[model samples]
Target: MTDTQEHTWGERYADSLMNTFGQPKLVLTRGAGAHVWDTDGKEYVDLLGGIAVNALGHAHPALVEAVTAQLGTLGHISNFFASEPQVRLAEKLLALLDAGPGKVFFTNSGAEANEAAFKLTRRTGRTHVVAAQGGFHGRTMGALALTSKEAYRAPFEPLPGDVTFVPYGDAEALAAAVTDRTAAILLEPMQGEAGVVTPPKGYLAAARTIADEHGALLWLDEIQTGLGRTGRWFAHHSAGVTPDIVTVAKGLAGGIPIGACIGVGESGTLLEPGNHGTTFGGNPVACAAALAVIGTIETDGLLEHVTALGQKLRDGLAADPRVTEVRGEGLLIGLDLAAEVSAAVTAGALAHGFIINNPTPHRIRLAPPLVLTQDDAEAFLTAWPAILDEAFEGQS
Candidate 1:
């Protein structure tokens, strides 16, 4: 395949697919490890890791084998019946969370998981939810109501009301907004969509205290930060606070479509038999993929690897004077550019065979796979200056 072939595929894609994502940047054909090849056969290191969903990278042998083996035996089954993988995966998630005696509601995506949690909060007889301003939960109507982005929420009006938005990382503001009537205080331990913004120290603990005082559920949305993306089973683990409800997806199944809305302690029983349901949420194949992802992360020591490599990448990326600030933990990294050139930088990086993301005008985010090699990180670092130079030239 050549550039001409890629262009042809792009045209075909435009004709066949909806333009929800604006335009196809590349027609990706195949992937292995942390690398992918486009229709034109151009190889690139996937530093964005499918927006933090590919925890084990692409086509990992363990993930493939698990899915294949599960599909061979039992694949899809209605929620009326349970399978071994589904039950086992739920237990495994509870064990990993270290939250005793919890219940899990499986979903197909993060938005669905958040929606499950949102409904669970409603069971407490309160409708008001206090969420952080810059935090992003999901795109569904229920999750969208909790998301504070005016642009995303504006177009979809009359969203489930009684949701209040407060400034993120501000414990004072969070404490003020949450009241006795608030059913839940929703937050992300570290904001992923707001360009990996981590809250101020003790903010989560403060939220817990406030929730306790107000009798509100403390719900942490770890869709992007959970399942070892942030060097821990859950990023909120670093804060040493136990949330009543936790929503996880993104990397939980290592590219397989699976999400879990876990409620701990009393909150676990909020959603009774009649409260919620899903047809394909806990399918055998997805559950098997999730178990395999967990097994691989433990066996390969990927958590420690992510922590070390992340620090190295951050130090190297921050060494460039063009980067004003760098934030995030483990493999989820975000850096601020000296200028609003993130769009040009991302385009330049793609041209240089490195994939990155621009979450905001001045922010560049990197959520590479846990399996990313030191060589790949070093290669990106080596190309950083030149990519910047090209992007700056484009701006000029």
Candidate 2:
């Protein structure tokens, strides 16, 4: 296709779609594994993996077969009735957590999962939640209230009130803010939207202790870092603390749009009858897709692959002096640039037939598919120097 053809689609998209996402970067036609082809037939290595949602990569046979088979058999059966896949998925998630007895409430997205958790916290007879600054939970009103970003929160004021924000990774700050009145102390094992910022060692353990001290629920939003993205079933696994509440989505269903809010131990009984509900929450097809994703991760040994590849990518990317820092675990990688050229770097990367993301002016994040090949990783590493050269062409 010609440039005009692409421009026509862009114009049509602007007219037809909402302006929430600004503009579509490319008119992607199809994808296989870690590669995608644009309408122009240009192939690019997909490093963002649909913003960390495509755990098994594009069009994996397991995910495709599971979704197709389930849809053909039984697709949507509202929450009024239960399905085998739904119950099995809930059990699988609990087994993965291995955090004693727990109950799962399914949703269609991460925001909905956090919303359910927010309401569950209210069941404890408290409304005050102390969430860390720089944490990105979700965009729903309740999740938005838990998020500390002023810009995202400012647009919708009078949000569920009494949510306190404290500096991330600071045990003293968290301890000072949480009290008996606090219902939950929410933290992301690793801040994804905030350029994949990671907390200090023992930060989550500290948060667990603080929450316990105040009798508050420890809620970890593992939306971005969970499901093998961090080389573990859950990012909080490394901290060795059992949280009362856990919210997960993103890669849960390998891009089939599923989220879960898991309440542990006594917290599971807080939300009794007539508490909350969803129409399309636990549909059989989505549940099957999630089960397939988990099965593949285990059978294919993708967690070990993610751990090794993540380290390689981090090391290779950090070889350049322009890269000031590298953070995150497993396939979720983020690096800082010495200069404010992340936009230029992203553009340069695209021109070189690789897709990357610039979350901030000086930060780039890469959450590639767990199935990303060693060849693709080497390709990106080999092109790293030249890409930076183009991005920093006119810089000091």
Which one wins on lDDT?
2
Superposed on all Cα atoms, model 1 deviates from the true structure by an RMSD in Å of 0.9
Question: How well does candidate 2 match the true structure in TM-score terms?
Answer: 0.99
lDDT measured at residue 101 in model 2 versus the true structure, 0 to 100: 99
List of clashing residue pairs for candidate 2: none
- Give one digit per residue, the lDDT tens place, for model 1 in 1-396: 767777788888889999989787887889999999987678999999999999999999999999999999999988999999999999999999987889999999999999999999999999999999898999899999999999999999899858999999888988889889999999999999999998888999999999999999999999999999989999999999999999999998989999999999999999998899999999899999999999999999999999999999999999999999999999999999988999999999999999999999999999999999999999999999999988777777
CA RMSD of all predictions: 0.9, 0.8
For candidate 2, write residues 1-396 as lDDT tens digits. 999999999999999999999998899999999999999999999999999999999999999999999999999989889999999999999999999999999999999999999999999999899998899988899889988989999999989858999999999999999999999999999999999999999999999998888899999999999999999999999989999999999999989989999999998888887999999998899999999999999999999999999999999999999999999999999999999999999999999999999999999999999999999999999999999999899575
What is the lDDT, from 0 to 100, of the residue 196 in candidate 2? 94
Report the poorest 10 consecutive residues by lDDT, candidate 1: 1-10
**Candidate 1: residue pairs that collide:** none
